[model samples]
Target: MATPPSLSPISPPSPPNTTTTAPPSSLPNNTAPPTPPVTNNSDPVADSPNGTFANLLPPPPPPRSVESLPPGTLAGLIVGVGLGALIVLIGAGIFVIFYRRRKKKLANNYSGAAPQGVDPQHWQQSVPQITVLPKPTPPPGITPHLYNSVEPPSTSTSLGSEKPSNASPSPVVAMGHSLGTFTYEDLAMATDNFTDSNLIGQGGFGYVHKGVLKDGKVVAIKQLKVGSGQGEREFQAEVDIISRVHHRHLVSLVGYCIVGVQRLLVYDFVPNDTLEFHLHGKDRPVMNWSTRMKIALGAAKGLAYLHEDCKPKIIHRDIKAANILLDESFEARLADFGLAKYSLDTDTHVSTRVMGTFGYMAPEYASSGKLTEKSDVFSFGVVLLEMITGYRPVDKIQRSLMIA
Candidate 1:
């Protein structure tokens, strides 16, 4: 075999000269010295005993490809995944907490406080607690009595002979349930003998006066005009309808009085005046768009409750602007249920005498005396027109008149 040529040792090339600078006195001299750079003579082929050309080049740059990750890289990936999972878990926990709190608040609003004077034992007993009605579902298995042919209770039995002036009038139990009752004396005293200053409003049937009961509760006392022809029927009808139904949008019946021939209805006093007053009263500030929209929505909801929720749905025979009263918060409530009539599920239209404000009556109801939920809708439309145009239903000056 021929002898291989001897390889000569190679010298490293000199580095280019750079100006050296001294550290400033303010800096410390504990810094480590710079590392010397490897030269061509430092090849693995020259250093190793079994050297080959394969070892001459650098050791393949320690495999920088993704497949060969560094030790620290794997640790960093695991730490990053753990941190992301922790963040997601924390976010989920926060969302669940907020949702539960909001749900509880809504439940409280829908379930209002029990009415004053409700017997605790009776409230806790089998009688189901009255909550804001979401829809009118009749009491389970209970037949709703129709008032279509209900005649006025005879004078002898209706209000019963007036109790002697010396004796306190006995409380009258409601037909289906126990409700508060007032004597003529009790209400007369509350209203200061129905002075003109106590009068809040007047309607075809009666005058409404603000009164304060002995229990410190404010009430609206509606004294029906004697011999109004329908006073007796209206009293019974209103009691039957409002006693069994409870809704946030409807005026709550506090109690009723039938002393001798005088008839009166007590209701929870709504602090604000009628929608008519705000909409048409002179020198009153214009109702803003938001407030007007709120009123409209609330009134629609009230009618919806009567038409869609009640078992034998009710048709608000009178849905004029005057009947829509507002509370201190400007919440709209449907008042005056004296003319409200029930429409049985089996009946297409209740055959009743036409009764409503002059210009707010529906044409079909006025001409045919046929009553249905549509009758109320027609009146509601007229009220909506009034709200939009800011005009009375019967504006004699404008020559604008709307019936039903």
Candidate 2:
């Protein structure tokens, strides 16, 4: 019951070469074209350019089909699916980033919410309101107070084996108003009617007089010239600017009074004279290098504080030796803020009228009115060089050169 194997395909053998006497009409009997005669070693199929391997023993197998895939196709499928998942993950990450940015922008515009760090409680700011409280009514058997309607009942026990009756209302407390405001007449009387002996110093705008209050406290009172709006403006500027500044080297303004065009500025009085006096006095001893360096450092620190530390960058337009005052400890304190300007808006040099002292002005600032931080630096340099040389910037040679 054994089965037969299939045989390989073969071409028909060629006939032997011979001289034939058959008629040409008999050629129709042979349906095939005659093959070339075969010799003892002649090849039936010779090499040709069209196809050398057409006569090969077997043809190649059919191209593999996906449905009937090879044994290792699962491994390829796994790798392809993993790559597709990675691409999808990257796409999702990009979408998440854009979504977060859009959400954050929307939240910033309104009642902001979500995983953001902003506190939701302060997101909606409500307008403030002013509320008035009603006073409570009096209890039974309590008579209304005289002169002060809000006064309370005062009851005291004498401990004499009987409940003591309420004592009379405090007469002094019931008499005067609680408003402790000090009037202009009071200040004038406390200052001894503006006496000349109280005069401590005179400035460009007004005179500074020393005063002693009834409580034995000393104070400096800056009195503006009567009926001078310019002096009043300067006084107001001093109060508004220095009141907000809190610095160790800056002079502090205490309180002020504006009485019928008579402007007054009060400050914590400094005990010693200005730096210009100490450095320029004839009988005063020459300042040593250490003392000069200390003064210079103090002035530089004050300038730096004004420039960087202040909320609004303030420029001390008249930062000269005359404006630096010394206290009882010889520590430098910046004074005379009348010409100060705020430079918060720009670093560009400003054009201003020449308001500074002559030898201290920068050449460009003096010529073209271009004032900047460099102008201050130049003024400081002149003061430092003057201290080192023991000569003023407006001395004989300096005046000639400056004039030239």
Model 1 Cα displacement at 212 (Å)? Answer: 0.5
Please write out the lDDT profile of model 2 over residues 1-404, one tens digit for every residue.
99999998887888667676554555665576666556554332454455555666466699987676676897899889999999999999999999999887665533213113323431221111212122223222434332111112211121012111123322122111111223345446556866888887786778888777666667677777765545544554464346445566777666555333345666767777777888886799888878888888877877776666553456666767777877876777787665555554345766666667788878888889776777777877877776677676776755555421
For model 2, state the Cα shift of residue 77 in Å: 36
Per-model TM values vs. the true structure = 0.58, 0.51
lDDT of 1 by residue, 1-404 (tens): 99999999898988667565654556346766555555556656665668776555666656566677898999999999999999999999999998898787555433432323432221211122222212222223434322111222222211122111212222332233234666666787899878899999986788999999998999999988764557756777676667656777888888776544466889999999999999989899999989999999999988887787665577889998999999988899998888887776677888878888889898889999999999999899999988998988788777766432
For all candidates in order, the CA lDDT equals 0.71, 0.59
- Candidate 1 C-alpha RMSD relative to the actual structure: 24.0
CA RMSD of all predictions:
24.0, 21.2
Question: In candidate 2, which residue pairs get closer than 3 Å at backbone N, Cα or C atoms, i.e. clash?
Answer: none
Q: Evaluate residue 364 in candidate 2 and report its C-alpha lDDT on the 0 to 100 scale.
A: 87
